[model samples]
Target: MPSLDDQPAASDLHHAVLAWYDMHARDLPWRRPEASAWSVMVSEFMLQQTPVARVLPVHEAWLERWPTPADLAAEPTGEAVRAWGRLGYPRRALRLHAAAVAITEQHDGVVPDSYDDLIALPGVGDYTAAAIASFAYGRRHVVLDTNVRRVFARAVAGVEFPATAVTRAERDLATGLLPDEEATAATWAVAVMELGALVCTASSPRCGACPIADVCRWRLAGHPAYDGPPRKAQAWAGTDRQCRGRLMAVLRESEGPVHASALAAAWDDAVQRERCLVGLIDDALVVRVGPESYALP
Candidate 1:
């Protein structure tokens, strides 16, 4: 439970971070100066739990189709879900569509400038909302995603990691690390997050290339090992999440509708397949076209 005082001063860390970012930042689409707020928002949503390589093409195609929240809201949910091909989390498609609709109706197709307003939209949780607000709107906020949290926990707290979920104390600590000026703070948050993604990765971190390595408390303490139990890996091949993804893929490929039997073909286990299909329909990721046909919604 180390505190900020026990680590390098905030100013030192900020300077190191900004300097490192300027020299080594990746050439990402969303990070471009010319990228629009809507494009940034779309990138943020797509990048969640997905890799940068997978998100690049999808983000480009998505923006090409619906440049604004109003443009997406104008289309059917099926089209949105269809465009979300193989992104792993299909529900995010529905939620992103819902958020677009909300933005179109409430904010006149514009991504909101305020953090509170952005958070009110569907699927825009603390991380997404803070990202949108800071990166897109240039507003000051503590953007604590898994990467940022881990970086800070190790660098400042000398702990191997933060909690599985962010806590209020983490939020407060993140906010404190922010610069006094709004613009600087926004840049710092992005830089730190990028640093974590590239250098301080979850496994086999590149400490040699880390910008703040010289002053990081964790490094000073000899990079002590994480003593916690190993995290359990979620099953993918024969799980409900896999079944849901397969069913959505079928609907995505089909223009009009797909037979329920067709979806059952995705899995061999009849009980599990049936259960997954029903869950998708119940979750509004898919809709029953008729008694036996289903389509993405």
Candidate 2:
């Protein structure tokens, strides 16, 4: 078992991973030293369940428009949703706008440096708050996103995946792995995340390119196939989610309120279409301009 104090062996693993990160970290805008705390916060939001490639242009356009939290706060909340632009899960855009409003109103337009304050903001959860703290402010935190959790699963737990949900055991393991120095701990957090993204991928892990492959518990165990509970993959086609996206696209592509007939044109099934439109309104993704008119909110 890879206990907290795996000792001299773990220390070597840490050095090796960090060294690899220094040489191989991707040149993401948010990773740059000049990236503002607000920028880091924005990246974290856009990145949730979305690919880096998908996020890049949207992030660039978002930054170009709302250069500061104050700038986003100044715009109508609806503009944020419209600008969100098919990123899927448009609620994140609303949450980000709300967070920007909070930052403007309470934090003097500054993205808080501490995890506590960051977590208090809208859309900022434990992972996001920790990421902004560590990546933006160089604070020590156990930043466990999917990527980081996967790395730890393979490298320490000899597993193909972490639990479907984070357990207390997993949380403690990550906390225990933190370096004593704040900056070093922050670096380690991102390094592990990057390693999982680039090398220890969930579908096609390149073990030959991994920094800690030699000491990886899963590798040492001869790469046994996962035999735990089946994981649910996201389904899109013919689903309400896609229906909702189609409806949202109609609203997003329009500058003014769209007629109910126009919205109905986006989807085929009348029952499913109405169900999805009602769900969107319930979710506050759409606002009724009139009894038969709809627009994005």
Task: Give per-residue CA lDDT, model 2, range 103-216, as digits (tens).
Answer: 999999899898899999888899999999999999999999999999889888888999999999999988888888999999999999999999999988999998888778
Model 1 lDDT tens row, 165-259: 77788888887899999999899989999999999998888999987887778777888888766777988787788777777788888888888
The lDDT per prediction is: 0.86, 0.90
lDDT for 81 in candidate 1 is: 84
RMSD of each: 2.3, 2.3
Q: Candidate 1: TM-score?
A: 0.95
Residue 168 shift from truth in candidate 2, angstroms: 1.2
Worst 10 residues of 1 by lDDT: 1-10
User: Which residue segments of model 1 deviate by more than 4 Å?
Assistant: 1-5
